[model samples]
Target: MSPRNTRPTTPRSGTRQSPRVALTPRAAELVRRLRAEHGPLMFHQSGGCCDGSSPMCYPYGEFRTGASDVLLAELGVDGVAEPVGFWMSADQFERWCHTHLTVDVVPGRGSGFSLEAPEGVRFLVRSRLLTDDETRRLGPGGPSHGDASADTSAHSRSGGPGRA
Candidate 1:
């Protein structure tokens, strides 16, 4: 099967934790292709002014993340054993604390710095507010609620949302 043919691994009952972000069939395929070329990759939603406010894909470690950033989710790429991380600035997270984000792609140009620009497509975040049950799970601050780190078998190496 073409790498693109792979589907997002369906989350199974009693088997996996809810993902912070997910990919559509199309986005997953693109990621598979990009990973083959770029090596491991990660996503950072531009915090606003400085980074152009577009979700960008980068070779892990190519872009710098720090304490000011919040780890939103660690995504499982369809054909890759390693998970891709998704992050937002701490400030940006404040506005989106109640929403679930999905990393999707469309045909167009995104931030010039994002690795996919040359491919003529860009990644976008599709969001929805968390349900009451999900909010309860969150408790307050941090991932999957307070515990930003989880051993959900979804990350590239460290099974967590990757701290900046």
Candidate 2:
């Protein structure tokens, strides 16, 4: 089967918590390729600035993240040595915390500064309303809310979106 047709692993039901973010199969494949060329990678969702709301890919640490950003998830892609951190602006997170986000890729030029722009594809976010269980798990404040350094160990090893 084509890799893109394969489904990402969903979280097992019951007590296991859901992940706040995930990557589509196509996105994972792109990440694997990018990692080979760039060494390591990280993603930050733009908060309607120069890049609008698209997810921006950068070489690890290329983008500065601080108190203004929220570390939403660490996506583990097959064949990649390290998980890719997914971050969002604290202000945007406040508006989006109630939803589950997925990273996907499409053919087009993105922000010139983002690593993916050179590859003729850009990363985008796909989101859905968090289920009751997921909302409760993340709580009203959402995972890691205002603190980028908050522990995200639970999401660090997850292969993809945590769906029952």
Candidate 3:
């Protein structure tokens, strides 16, 4: 006989939190422009240097936030009754919200958010760095995705203004 699927079919229980991020008119406009250009955006909190918490936005790909195994204490976010679309730590999610950005999950690539920027340039933030190949995929006017190596190399050699 075929083995029965053991995964829990029941949907997790929890209240849906309203997206309460706030943005200036300029920022909102920027978000709109980016949405019009790119298909969707993603948001995430990752383990980084210092306190080990940093927020990142992505243009594509699937990412998990607020998973069952994640510890609420570590994330530093509160008032969450259930795991949302992603497996973000409570604290990190709070920080993203504090930035006044709204997160959305798309059907194909992944989940992300749109932010309005005062500057005319629309920016894309991602949890992971973009590979050189991925940057090429962006066609034109997209932010750099790969390592800081590419960005820092020129500055190191130039010893420009900020350098000693």
Per-model CA lDDT versus the true structure: 0.64, 0.67, 0.29
Please write out the lDDT profile of model 2 over residues 65-158, one tens digit for every residue: 6667777776677678666777788789889977888788999999998887888899988889978876655544443432344322232235
Which regions of candidate 2 are displaced past 4 Å? 1-18, 145-164
Give the RMSD in angstroms, all C-alphas superposed, for model 1: 7.7
Better of 1 and 2 by TM-score: 2
TM-score of 3: 0.29
Model 2, C-alpha of 23: deviation from truth (Å): 0.4
Q: Which ten residues in a row have the lowest lDDT in candidate 1?
A: 1-10
lDDT of 3 at 52: 44
**What TM-score quantifies how close candidate 1 is to the native fold?**
0.74
Worst 10 residues of 3 by lDDT: 1-10
Better of 1 and 3 by TM-score: 1
lDDT (10s digit) by residue, model 3, range 1-164: 00011111122222222222222333334434444554343334454553244334433223332221121111101222111212234444444322223332222222123232223243322333434653443344311122222211122234421122
RMSD to true structure for each model, in Å = 7.7, 8.9, 19.1
* Model 1, span 131-155: residue lDDT tens: 8866765555464211233222233
